[model samples]
Target chain A: MTTGVRRRLGVEERRQQLIGVALELFSRRSPDEVSIDEIASAAGISRPLVYHYFPGKLSLYEAALQRAADDLAARFVEPHEGPLGARLLRVMGRYFDFVDEHGPGFSALMRGGPAVPAGGTYAMSTVSTTNALIDSVRQAAYVQILSHLGVTDPPARLELVVRSWISLAESTALIWLDGRRIPRAELESQLVHDFAALASVSAAYDEEMGALLRRVFKEEPADGPFADLAGRLLTLAT
Target chain B: MTTGVRRRLGVEERRQQLIGVALELFSRRSPDEVSIDEIASAAGISRPLVYHYFPGKLSLYEAALQRAADDLAARFVEPHEGPLGARLLRVMGRYFDFVDEHGPGFSALMRGGPAVPAGGTYAMSTVSTTNALIDSVRQAAYVQILSHLGVTDPPARLELVVRSWISLAESTALIWLDGRRIPRAELESQLVHDFAALASVSAAYDEEMGALLRRVFKEEPADGPFADLAGRLLTLAT
Candidate 1:
């Protein structure tokens, strides 16, 4: 243990350190499976010291999940200079990176279980907090995608398309984490193509989406992912 | 309450009547909001009689959910005589009919909340049973879709596409149930179009998916949803 050589740390620094350690442990295993003792031991601190920073395991688990949520939300942030398909592909790449790194934790969070308080007074509130955190992440991703689309006021159909695509990406990741059967790169590109496909189908129904598609296609290069989707569809049509 | 002229029912008939009453109450409001007293009153029976058929509220909720789940799974069943698009549209129609009718119960079931036993000895097990019921419904829908495609062995990408579409439909319905500003008919047809869109995008990535798409398209008439999607894409291409 590093207890023998423990260095002084500020309160904020210690809390951050503890959260990092807890997240590390929680990532490897479900949060419910981890304990305050384990976190303290991993952090080279005492259980009492861990309690001094966070009241209980639930608070500590929320802190770790908060950090993970922020990191996940950040993965959707990309500059709007490149083609949307490539930007989305990059986002998917980083997204899968996080999912790959934290399989069990991600599953538990998405499934809303195992980490939740069991048969306690705080169970319902904790469940809602977990769901709120998940919803916030989805909202962040939705806003980021809308920003990339450059639409301040998305039509109802466009909104449906975006929200549906976000859910598709989420479910795709959850299923992929179940078994890494399909190649990651293919899934990533296919997700970008899925965005195009969703938008195009919506465009067929709404004039605004039709116009949006035209603008999107006008910016896409011949070798970009959107063009790639178009080429495949054209080939199939022929 | 029909208490003035109660009719005798067999044991099996009594249980079935209780289940139907519970489902009706649960559908009108969240299951947690409806109580044993209300259920008994609705069934025109005593609380002890209700308990005679089921142990507690959780078991009764499960029985109700089981009936709802079976009804939902059956909504996906269609004769293999028509175009895939028409068949899927019919499925979406009936699926949304359930969502529209049982808004609160469907939401609670999907979100995994409220109706669940709150911080009790049976809470965890009840939650898992609720989840199991939801998963079973998804499994039934997935198997039904694969059967519709007539594929005994679906490749990984095809599987992903199908599973992702199922999730998409679910999320779409959930979101639509929130505001429901968009016309129900539009969303229903769009969901069918979404299936074609998702499958076609996957086709671009895998030969198996590509072959599946060709078969799907060959069966789709010019005026069908699949052809409509093709028309939209081709219009954009030119």
Candidate 2:
């Protein structure tokens, strides 16, 4: 045991150190695969000391997940200039970059199990506040996102559409990570174009989306996606 | 042992009967949850008699899975009547109907497990022909699907789009099965529209898609989805 030279770290600092070590371990493998002994060894502390900071592996894993979520949420905080699609492209670019960086963790978080299992000794459902806290953070980012998309008074269907698009992006991102079946840049464009296409379709049935679509097109460039797509549709009639 | 009462049966017929019993049990819960004891009890036979037809649980499960796979492929066989999208809707309706009917088995099939894992004396991986048969059946359906979409002279991009659209349908189907978030009819329409939107976007960048899309439009209803979408796009410019 390396118990001879115990450093007198403050409670908060020691907790952070343990968490940092835990995050590194959790990032490599799923939480279920990781063990308490691994975290303690990596932190250069005994098992009891690791437990002192966090009650169990689930707690340690949650903290590490929070760290990654915070990093991802920060990437969406973008300047609202240029065309709406371009702005979203940058936001998505950042999102993809973060996914690329935290490949394993991003996948685990997206999978979100033991997190929302029907039964577990230390299930995420028992920790009600964790989900609440995460949802609050996520909803705030979606609010920022809706504003940039000019979706001020989003209809119920539009809200569902936006949320569904997010889920699609997550699933497609996972596939891209594994297969690179389509090029990364095309993947990004495909998602952007999908958003635009869905918005146009939504505009047909959703009153709020019509105004939102026009506003998006107003700021969009003459030769860009907005104009290009409209031209294609017009060509159908001519 | 019902040795005195047991009827004389052909080997293949007994094998089919045992597989049918196993499929019913598998259709209720996942393959992992099922046990040989339960299967024998359900079939009103002894455990050894259960083994007489199939060596173990894994073999039975694979046979059950193969049955479901064949059933699913059969559902996609729609007569090419009405619009292409309408034809696809009928195909998807059958698909979703199958999913609804065989909920647990459908999920397990999709999960495609090592459900009956190690030490299974009759493991499925050893039955190499089962996978080949399923894959060949699946490829034939994909070929049929590509033809229906007018994807003649398909480029690599078209193939990716076809395959990605399939994934989207699947992911969305799973979501529908769980949430019923959108009405099944709307889900079908949304998927159909998503395919059309993707095709148009693809047409712009792909020569093969450009030809394929026009051919699709030539056969499409003037006042149906094509006109409706073009009208919506024209609304944007004016």
Candidate 3:
């Protein structure tokens, strides 16, 4: 038994540990509901020690939010080898996994936590930081989707299609988290098909998007989500 | 002459006039930046008269927001029209008209006005009321879409497609207002096509949605947005 021994952590390590602990607590409850005392207790540290690492709860909340944002952004990354539809499905899967794991925290983050002060420069900056983090996540996703399309300079229509799809995926996830009524697998595949749908519509209006879709479709397997969407739409013709 | 006469107004009319004046002021600038004195002056009344009608700026702001919400909701209404696509296009057009007219107010409403207080039951209730108004708009749009589809009871998939499109349209408008690089007419039509795209993908997954799409397509003209979507997807075949 090593009950008597206590280990000392380096400055950065202690901070990271506290963030990790705070995030865990926040994952289960809204950040506003979880106090600094609870976070310190969870990490086996004194309240003063917690304050030593971070000035206050708002700062700690921001640190935890930063960690969560990074994790969320990483979920969008996938290998370039697979078909685009399949890649997007995997991304949605991981995204939902994160949402499922961090329910209240995710909602609080997106909806703006209950504790958010209505006024004050300090509170305003915190809100802006929170917004900036959220925007960064959206930007990361936009870049990832563009990379999947392999387009460095996208036409305006293409940009709209991509950006709109990202927003669709986001709202879908947020609403899904509310009741989770539909099967996750079905929503995942449907979202992948949604991308195809948005792109197809954009392609109709823009030659550049048309060309991009053709290029995307050529790489798709017959049973892939993109082809699957084609097969479904074709049923109407018969 | 008539110019020397001061027109007397009833209490309700005066209150309505104040709200209209406040809404006009709020449309151009964020509500926080607009003061009661300005509203009073804009209405050609004294500041005490403005206070008599409303307790504080927040209450008046809420009233303005309520008026805006009703106006926004009315934009979604279309008389059970010829083609769903054309009807949706009209809806989007009018919707964007509101966004275009109330640019700052629209942004401030959706983003939460900069002056929102961080805490206090009064402020918290205001936030909830604001959120409730926003949700009412979404719900109104949802009901309107369902009515256009002529479905009293929709499947989960159908609900998902409609709700997701609503969210997509919202985010699209919010993003569009930032720089408004694309032509508004094009976006309005694209949004109509977006609805078709979202539904088509859902139809591919659910037989009920498939049946609904087939029924919908039968009435749609060859050049309609729905058929146009089908036509675009057919291009991938060649």
Candidate 4:
């Protein structure tokens, strides 16, 4: 109110600004602690404008969750080029960045609870639908990850394996954040190594696992994440 | 009034029976849906007796969670015999058993939410605490796994890798339960391989990893869970 003339923002710009402000605030505090007024003030707009964009606090929170999920999901989406190991390393780097920025929000959503919302987009369901919310977000994220792993059309078993890897990454990321006991690069490499081991084991039954392993090995740089994996996997195949 | 014989049981047996009844009840539905009167009836006792043991519904829920966590943690503690891969497979078998018998209960605790109690044992904190519950359960179990792997005292980095592997197992178990798409044997073998792969990566930095890899290969039977691993590791060392 005191600041004389506010710069006019386009609908999209205003919507984005409001969501960004709300995201930052909610990242620090729960949805209940955040107020429409705070979001408006943060963006140099009025409370009504905030309401116009989000309708209510729950709606605002859902938009933020969608934005955060989209941002995190986007990290796993890299160009479908390069050796699988290098692509994974790059994706993990972006993942670490997201974990660092939204530690609380990420855990809250991942844990599946009442603190988050399920508005029209992200969590839009009532209390009974929390599982659905978690399932949708998790499944969608895994589809992207399995694709990056070159199992774009993952068989049910291969897809399960990739989903397991994703869960392991989530656990490792949380631990890594708390106890920087291990170097970031080492942690990333460890994950890549685990996936390699899974692929090797998967070969015992599924020809697809064997073929995928061969492709990754052929595509991998001679001296990169796959170097150590090479001797282990290559020896096993023969 | 219903039964002619009112059998008197010891305090501990009665308490155990009550917990078992409550667990069976809650395992089917979320904690919110179960009531004290029903739990008492299921145990063939009065509501006052149930209250006498648990004081309230929250206390009963907390006891069940601690029991489930202990039960799952207990699975990781097989007799420390046999090769590491065999030991892991055994433990994973027990883990899958826990996941199957107490699917929803295991998931509810693992997800870390308001539905469970934090009375004295676990998940009794804020969003930050959610990570702690996961970390606590994970570290405790990994300690056993590391012990079985001949890492009686795991170094900081190896410990981190084990934590990551445990996370992967948790994720795989969750996915496996949701979709019986993957065979139980396949899932177990994949986890064993992931740990083996992590060991190889660690060998690059630590002498212990090298020594253990040597031991696992040396002690491995002519034919066992890690036959595939032996081909790769043995060939590489030569």
Candidate 5:
């Protein structure tokens, strides 16, 4: 007779379960509003068991956030098949969808809190990894587009364009999430169109830059950290 | 000897004093972190006097915020002088400078929070005003540019473009305030260059647009709400 709690789960499985529950609670309230006792009770687990796993509420919150962040960085940064514009759109969509799905959590993370919560340290390197990936892709795409269009500008201009695109995309997503201005489909369509306008201006593929991007897309295994991240995201989200 | 404190001030003068003190305290900490006691003490006034002038901390905070918002709305929404690009750059610079000068207060206003003491109520009209002004200016600019160019896209597409530009400008400002890699001068130059790139594609009647922009620039009045907001802002800072 197999009981629901009879089957033993591995450490990874239990850890994942803890993170899953934590994410939901964190998303429901600001950081200051959530407490470990609430999390433990909601999870139907003992306080001691929760403490053993997370050390503290802050540690638990950070761990959950890190998992989500790493999952996103891995998915978006990984090289993939498709035109640079298409690839960029897909990555941006993933991010927007994440925010849309987890509104309060995203708000807390981006806006931060009154003080650094005990567990939530300012992890610059972790966040920068994502930013750097975006910069690199943007630079490559910008160079490709500008060269094709016969616009003579320094490589730095490409950085500015890409960053601007990112800034706009982020704000747009945030506003959409906050305002519920349109249905999700309409919002995403508008986002794609807006992205294409900017991308079309900056993603003209020159021979050499195209070749470099192609190589980056090919040499790296398709099933890399990015795919892993996507897989994790699916597991948590679905 | 006519001591500065001896003479009874008018309603406007007293209101200004309360707003100044409120802005100063709100900027330094979350509304929850501040107290009426602290505000009165800091302003060199009695607690009862503070309450007499303004019902509560929330009212004082909103009054101060409303003035700032009104100034920003007038500047960004109302007609201004100069080329659209240059005008936008100047307005954006002013916005950034305002944020830089009164970061704590600005930050508090930007991040809408739950009514912290029993009397405090969260209001986000200031952010809305900023968005509306940006939209208005961008829309007017787009119409002029498109009419000049004699090319047409659907209104939706135009909205996307304008929204994209405004969002980028705003998010760029946010990043700048966050003290990220983008310096003020570099951000300005990049924004101008990108604006040019877009305008070059979309703009027509190069000479006419320039002339009209110049006239608009000349007509812009400096002695307005922005000056008033600045004056009020300085009072709060001390």
Candidate 6:
């Protein structure tokens, strides 16, 4: 150890420095392409110093990933009390902004696997966090839409809505990232419109589907105003 | 060269053999995990002979991918003059059937992109082919839906329906692949129901949004429908 080198930084400062340097390197290269040696060299510290702060490269990566994930989770959850559409729009905006600002980190996370053996657990943990985030967002959006629609009961209904919305959002984001032929603005507009439509349509249809389904099971669809509709639904199923 | 030791095969037979062997390897490991050397050895041929049939590893992977893609496209594009819902069901059934039958090949294609960078151009081409097939299936489904609705006009309307429907299908499939939480039968049922709802809602909302937008441009209605809608949309703008 060179006695001339300063080593008086607090634990928090050292941890933060290591993460900041690691994130920069990780963003620039895939996990396999980056090494702890490179991280220590870039940070102007000894490899053992880096090891003292984190158990290993994998542990460092996992800590960094959890920090980034926590940031995203904070933006998407809670404060769910606004008008249904408004709240969802806010979450979506935050989501897209996060990806745009941090394209490299977002890309690695979205790509959903490790590029190195040391990164495998970190990569998988991030994926699990993402899935949970998606599920939570879906639920928030579903509750908002159902409240707007005035549907109080029917356990399966809200789950259906949330799953469907998540499906739409995730798929759109995946295709959009590939830089396909579609103009970016139009792609964004399309998603917004679809979300609005999904909410509005469920409001109208669920009521009808519920009533019609109940009657068809009774062998007694002989009376409701939408009796003909019920008959046709069964016919289509057959 | 002992004649008995090296039996010669024609170009077509050799190409087919190479694809079969590559696909087998892909089944065991994803495209990125498999090597050209393994493929050549498994096919009982020299490394150069494998290249003789296919330009490179990427081309061989693409060829194998294209075969499965073609089968899926054929099923999706197959004609059926029927009700919108029925036709969509048939197409959806075909899609799930294709995935079930060729789980590995479908998974590889669905997990699109040249994992090991034979280059981005190959990925771009694969994306285009995939987008085209998706578009085709979507148009067929749209035509059926519009026929059911008894609407025929300026082509833009049909294009809108097709685009939305394609997005719906693409999202549904991705979610289904990612989430094995739901039983297959239940997933299929929910898919049909949700898509039908989406199609109906999208149609109605488009018309409503278009009219409201026109009024905002022209007269700006008192306590206008778009007043709060703007703030809600601004939430989307970030």
Decide which is better by lDDT, 3 or 6.
3
Best of the two (2, 5) by TM-score: 2
Candidates, ranked, lDDT: 1, 3, 4, 2, 6, 5
Worst 10 residues of 3 chain B by lDDT: B113-122
Model 4 CA deviation exceeding 4 Å by range? A1-15, A25-60, A107-137, A146-153, A215-224, A232-238, B1-5, B8-13, B28-37, B46-56, B111-136, B149-153, B205-208, B211-224, B232-238
Every candidate's lDDT:
0.84, 0.67, 0.81, 0.68, 0.51, 0.54
lDDT of 4 at A134: 54
Pairs of residues clashing in candidate 2: none
Model 4 lDDT per residue over B112-198, tens place: 453543232222233334445555677679778767666677777677677777777887877777757878777777677767666
Best by TM-score: 1
Per-prediction TM-score = 0.93, 0.64, 0.89, 0.77, 0.50, 0.50
Model 4, A77-148: lDDT tens digits are: 788887778888888888888877877666555554546422222222433344455556667767776777
A130-161: candidate 1 lDDT, tens digit per residue: 77888899999999999988898988888888
Docking class of 5: incorrect
User: What's model 6's overall lDDT?
Assistant: 0.54
TM-score pick, better of 1 and 3:
1
When sorted by DockQ, best at the front, the candidate numbers are 1, 3, 4, 2, 5, 6
TM-score of 1: 0.93
- Candidate DockQ values, in order, are 0.54, 0.12, 0.44, 0.28, 0.09, 0.08
Which of the numbered candidates is closest to the native, going by highest DockQ? 1
Model 3, span A1-238: residue lDDT tens: 1122248989999899888888888888876688777887788878898899999888888898899899999989999987878888899899889988898888877763335332422356676677788889989999998998899997777777788888898778877877788898888888888888888777887787788888988998988888877877787556
Interface RMSD of 6: 12.6
Each candidate's interface RMSD: 2.5, 7.7, 3.7, 7.6, 18.3, 12.6
Residue lDDT tens for model 1, B136-229 = 8899999999998899898888888888899999989988887897898998999998888888888876788888789878988989887887
Candidate 5 has an lDDT of: 0.51
